[model samples]
Target chain A: MASDDSVSLRVTPLFSLCQELGARFTPFAGYRMALSFPAGTLREHQHTREAASLFDVSHMGQIVVSGPDRVALLESLTPASIRALPPGRLRYSMFTTPTGGVLDDLMIACRGDDLMVVVNAARREADLAHLREAARGHAADVALLEDQALLALQGPAAAAVLSALAAGVGDLPFLGMGPFALDGVLCWVSRSGYTGEDGFEISVKATHVEPLARRLLADPRVAPAGLAARDTLRLEAGLCLNGADLTPSITPVEAGLGWVVGRERRLDGQFPGSDVLFQQLAEGPAWCRVGLRLAGRAVARPGAPVLDPQGAEVGVVTSGGFSPTLNQPIAMARVPAALASPGQPLAVRVRDHQLDALVTALPFVPARTVGRACSGPSEPRNKP
Target chain B: MSKVYYTEDHEWIRVEDGKEGTVGITDFAQAQMGDVVFVELPPVGTVLTQGEQAAVVESVKAASELYAPVSGTVVAVNPDLPDAPGTVNEDPQGEGWFFRLALTQPNELADLMDQDAYEVFVAEAGESAG
Candidate 1:
């Protein structure tokens, strides 16, 4: 569907099915998307953690870059090593400005001939424009695949549910992508998702999305999840939302995304903002992104000012919310590097009074992504 | 039965006696807020003015302010909220009472809508928000 704000909202192919299942619709990124089903956000959040949930993420922008110099062109826009990425694998990268600030975080999949990029819906227009400029500069071809509908089936039971519907899906490794057929309809399946749970993101033709979703939902283990649960899931997983966590002034090093930048690229210093990024790497950023475990139940949402023990403003919370899995309030903030250590006491000015908070490690809940060991440094469980 | 009155902000006040009343959000408010995870109540003996921010209700996705329905002094608050805030979502009108306010101007109750009028107001709000 076409994207426009003044005109009617763009509808996903599964819109009617979601309506039939009693979904509450909300306008998101110029599309009418399901906020939650009749079971509500809480039930949907818990269900996905306990079992499995299907999410309609068709509003995101999916693009394909091809040509003889495709990898070279893609590498110019992002800091990640696009030329080194192996086929059938996905890498999480960001389009950075010359000043090292993030334009958008995206998942790039190398498919031998062309590279597929999945970008955030809110930044779709800007990302496309950026891609066009890069293509013009490098003489490459970029096409937005508007005819595809992307769906994510996530949770512990996600693999089983997907394997039952499509063969060869269960064997895919984490961050793996390949062509597959669901009920004889050609689709591309990736063994990755934003929930930090073992799951798959399936891209199918718009016309085939409804039947595929309905067939997958027929299993007792799968339930329809919406944007509300998705946001909480990602927050609990310590994943960054594009606009909130990664902003125009926040660099990858400052956002704890140094792992995404390849070492070879770091040594050669060829990408955008490479000089500044190298300097930041040598001397840590002024502010480092850290996770905060709030003392009380009062949620510290985004824009809340983070303060030190002496009532000095140290940082600002980028993403904060109530964690359904942890059963407490958790937040991510960008604070001075000196006070970023775990167990450091901090205060958050939520509304009127300052609430006590502790600087803790990220991923409020431990991630259970399949075939991947927990990446970050191991920390004690349940400190707060 | 105590007479229930509603504010334009969707807060409900049930007058228990001539001088004291209880305040809480209506079922419509809680439903719209999704899951209630935390509730911040005004301390006892705090003086409140009509249409002023009195308490805070935090859900999974958002935090909403609960306004004072009538001018009063908070005499009591629900003690079960800190440990279990879902009580507001389970039974918002009953055990979910936010606080007991001793009315300073009982005549201010006339400014609120009755149950019937509140239902009509809620319908209009739903239409506008939708």
Candidate 2:
């Protein structure tokens, strides 16, 4: 574990705010994180639906690409078209290895000058090296924002919550970013989140995190949430975890993220792994990622083998759990192309028992448009 | 006439008709583990020694091992827990009871703590240090 190392994972300025709000703490990616609170995961999940919740996402890696040619330099690496991204707009992009597998999926926001990229906590070091090597001597300077803390306030009342705390915050729409003072603390505010809800991600200096978090959480609708609820929330929303759902072994197409690949970049063939991606794009991969809905009460956990009617192993589950929203076991698996069809009958081998499961369309929970142009949580229908 | 005893592991046992006892977790255990969602009880005929896990209590966070206060053979289980797990949190000592066991040896009761001692122990144990 990273805990055994001398250097500890950095805590966000909102750590004290989380403690004051009654968050249950646990270790995640070397950082101590809240698991849930007195209300438990169920209520916390509901709170996001009925109101709003705050999450301390300081563990995520934030880096700034500055100097001339930064956009074009970053554009050469990710599949998402960074050069065309308007100032103050954010886009989801993935970094690919030489073999065309995903190194990591990240959110890149283009400011007037510098390019701000937010990545998964677990992949921070590797992502930094990948970007550094690509940007080396390319008129770009990579600066990691280690002194800043990242916080996410998400759910139905997110805009209202920010509107109550800061001026001009309510004006920022989805994927929009602007500078503002939150509770007298200067910070960068973005109307974006991972939970498929209307929300804002705030970047503040380390010292001001706690006070600002408390001020925002003072709203009656806001509650302190943890990683447990966050995981379930993102899973229910059909968002993929970097290491679990994506890896260097899987390409963007195989991972169902073909849309993020910019068309111009494909024709130009500048980025690494472009050849493999082009090939896969032309000829569909043999195996593709698909959503799996179990038939019985049993849950098909990660690493559980997927079998056909003849009981021959065909695929493996990468992420699975009992979704609080759907009220049944749901999973994402990499199965044979033939068995990846919606409504196809398959079985997940749990222990010595074979639980009946079915192949369902990805994003089992259909994205709904709640108020404020935010995509609401996906709800996968239960079979058992 | 019978007596109920408690263990530091959060289990409670009440002596029944000679050599038989009813076992379940205390109210403190349920409270510490927010909402009780599932319980895995031992089979009726299964025999268990003292300190062995008698049942499994799972909440939203994770699953916990429920140890036995006294050695015994399983006799009955609460069928109501599978569908209505909140019963255990509402009444860990009554309708939410886990199982009945036929005590293998009556002398094992000496190792358990009485209600009064268990109360003091629970007070100092804090929340979920286990």
Candidate 3:
């Protein structure tokens, strides 16, 4: 179900600019998003790892919960320590079902009195409905920020590029958020990105997004990237894609996202599906997510079978691609926890070929974020 | 002198002796499929039928099959493609050729579109697909 080719398509604010820059359009979550620019996906991916890339992530759903009870309402929705987060801080979280399955993964940023939550494009409608239904008699004001556009400027050189345009941007911590003036344009910027790079995700008004995009593209270190590069970069970072690696039937514990369930939430158990999740935490989920380094040059597309050493079908590949950073094929799979140890031998069935693969550590390409403790490339750990 | 013919699938054959031709995907095809990371060309002496999948082209986004434009036997593949598959995206119609084929049914060429006809086909296809 990774196909985002919806029947009808709407264009984003930067759609025309993307076309002018020689973009290949792919229908994603009902929007005609660029799959890649003239530089292509591979080059754009490499460029982001080295310099910086400007991605028009306008299609992502931005919802802001503002009011006296905004923080309380958000705390009741997810398992992250939202109540404990100070202003201008961000936390990665997910909505879990009563069965402990993940409904959707979202980014929650705490503004002074408002909580800004960014959900995946495909799950936006459902997420909005769920939030609204939960806020019937509550004091929280649930509204989608459709009037705003989200742009991600990511890579190792991302800070240098943004610091050149905006003041005080380089001072923000890894998950810090604040408002900054860029050439007279006000923008809500966050020192974070999905690509595991030292970058910023800027939320700006729809009418003002194009000029800001142009100004950023004018920088020699910044180039246009697209959804394809976005997907590959997240894969390299070992991030899960909702509807693929995560779904309503896949719990966060099983998805190897136990990190999102903070210690306070684990004891209080106020979130949905706390019972099933607590059980899984004490025991273990039958199937768990694992990082893999494929043997050959071909990519192991999602839905490809994962075979045990004895050639028995044991798992399924959730996400995969040729890692431009690693210069080899890598994939993530859901397999038995017993088979998920580091250096465990396995094989992936891609078309008519069965390539030998090993259970490798995630974040195949180490993250280079600023002011953050990034994991080493070969750090062998059983934890997520 | 060799002459070129085109297929609706955006494949091209440069026929020199009318019985054998060098085959490669058209520039439009390469552009349609982003940057090619791998091209799975058939081995020499492999038999192919017209409209059959003769090779696989894997881009960063997805993989697609390259259909044979006419029936032929694989003579040789571009030796440089395995390591430098980006050539298919850079010079798709020239040195980036996929393979050479000895035509089994040469008359199948007549059913394909000529250069002018293909230009028109690409125009209409691009408009409709876009």
Candidate 4:
């Protein structure tokens, strides 16, 4: 394990605010980010599901790609249909290696002449290098927004809180992005988030983030959450973390992210690793990502060996944790494609024991993202 | 009142009658772990050696090994933990006791730290971590 002293750590603009709110710091992507607040991870998870929560996500890499050939330049690096994306719409995509491996997964939002992209903090430098290399000889300029601070307000009550702060924010559709002002502070607001909740991600000047975060936290419904709750929230929502669920060696098809690849791109074989990805899509991947519902409370953390029915190691768990919402241990693992069915039986090696587990459908808890009407019952149907 | 002893790994054992002892993680340990979601305890009658892995405690963030502070045989394991593991975070020194052990060598307790020494050790550890 790498110690904090091994790397120089940076702090977000809201670092002092986090400290004032009783945040426990943890080293992440070379930044001293908040791991959890005094309310704890379990409570923070529950609070985010029930109410609104604010997160400082400034560590992520934010860049703007502009010029007449921006879409074409970006398309050469990613498999997404960048040319077809309309203004104010966000699309999740991945930068692929030549050999069908995922370089990094990112969210790209079209802003008329420019495209705004958000990449993982850990892979920011590499992603920028990759984009620069791909944009060579193209009429595109990639500008990193170093002075921006990104904050995400997430949960079922996010819209209500945001709309209260800004009148027109509630009008933005899911995955929609546009310029908005929060108390006269210019911000780029996106009605999207990683937690599968109805929320908005606001990008503003670093100088304005502290006040904005403080104002949002002043609301009774909005609590300050940290990286700990963020991870569990995404895991419960079946969302994959970049380094955990995705790696340079894992293709989009194997990671169950083939939906991000546009149909035309898949057929044209134009993007990097398109040949390998097309083959996997047509012939099926050797191993695929699946959700595991452990029989007991023991959690099968990342790197835990996933065993077949015969007690042979078949694959490895990429991410696992106790789902506070489900009140049980859930995990995401890459197992043999044939054994990735929803009801297949498997075992997860948790320490000295191989605990009983079953392959289940992703998203242990149903996502309550906005734009979808809450027509059904409010209570969850399946009990873990 | 029974005497309480602590280990370098932050486990605490309260010895009663010099034979039976109740063991659990220290309050400092639980605080550092953030939240306790699951705990795997040894079965009754399982023999444990001092400083060996005897149990597993997990939180949403990570999993940690719980080493036995003294050589003993597990006499009883906490039954309430499976349903309410948060007790470890709520009251780690009291209701959250992990298991009861029958000491095989009571003399081993002499090597452990008492409350005062354990407090000093924890202070030093916290300083280094900070």
Candidate 3 lDDT tens digits, B24-97: 99999898888888778899999999999999888888888888889999999999998888999999999899
Best by lDDT: 4
- For candidate 2, give the lDDT of residue A379: 25
lDDT per residue (tens digit) for residues A116-202 in model 3: 999999889999998988777579899999889999999988899999988699999888899998767899999888897789999
TM-score of each: 0.95, 0.86, 0.95, 0.95
lDDT of each: 0.87, 0.78, 0.86, 0.88
Superior candidate under lDDT, 1 versus 4: 4
Pairs with backbone N, CA or C atoms under 3 Å apart (clashes), candidate 1 = none
Alpha-carbon deviation at A4 in model 1, angstroms: 15
How many pairs of residues collide in model 1? 0
DockQ of each: 0.47, 0.25, 0.46, 0.56
Question: Lowest summed lDDT over 10 consecutive residues: which window, candidate 4 chain A?
Answer: A375-384
Q: Candidate 1, residues A1-384: lDDT per residue as tens digits?
A: 111242478888888999899887778888889988888888999998999999999999999999888888878888878877889988888998888989999999998889999999989888999999878878679999989999999999998898887869999888889999897899999988898788899999999999999999999999999999999998888888888899989988888887767766887667778777788887877778889999889999999999999999989999999988888899999899888888999999988889999988877788788767222211122211
The TM-scores of chain A alone, one per candidate, are 0.95, 0.91, 0.95, 0.95
Return the TM-score for candidate 1, rounded to 2 decimals: 0.95
lDDT of 1 at A21: 94
Tens-digit lDDT track for model 2 on A1-384?
Answer: 011231464455666666666775666787767767778787887788668988889999999999897977787787777766779877878888888888888989888879899999888998899889888759899989978899999888888888877868878867888888888888999888877777889999988887787777778889888887787677766777888888899887787666666767777777878888777777877778888888644556678999988999998998886666776678898887778778989899876668888887767554422333321112232111
lDDT digits (tens) for residues A355-384 of candidate 4: 999998877888887665311111121211
Judging by DockQ against the true structure, name the best candidate. Answer: 4
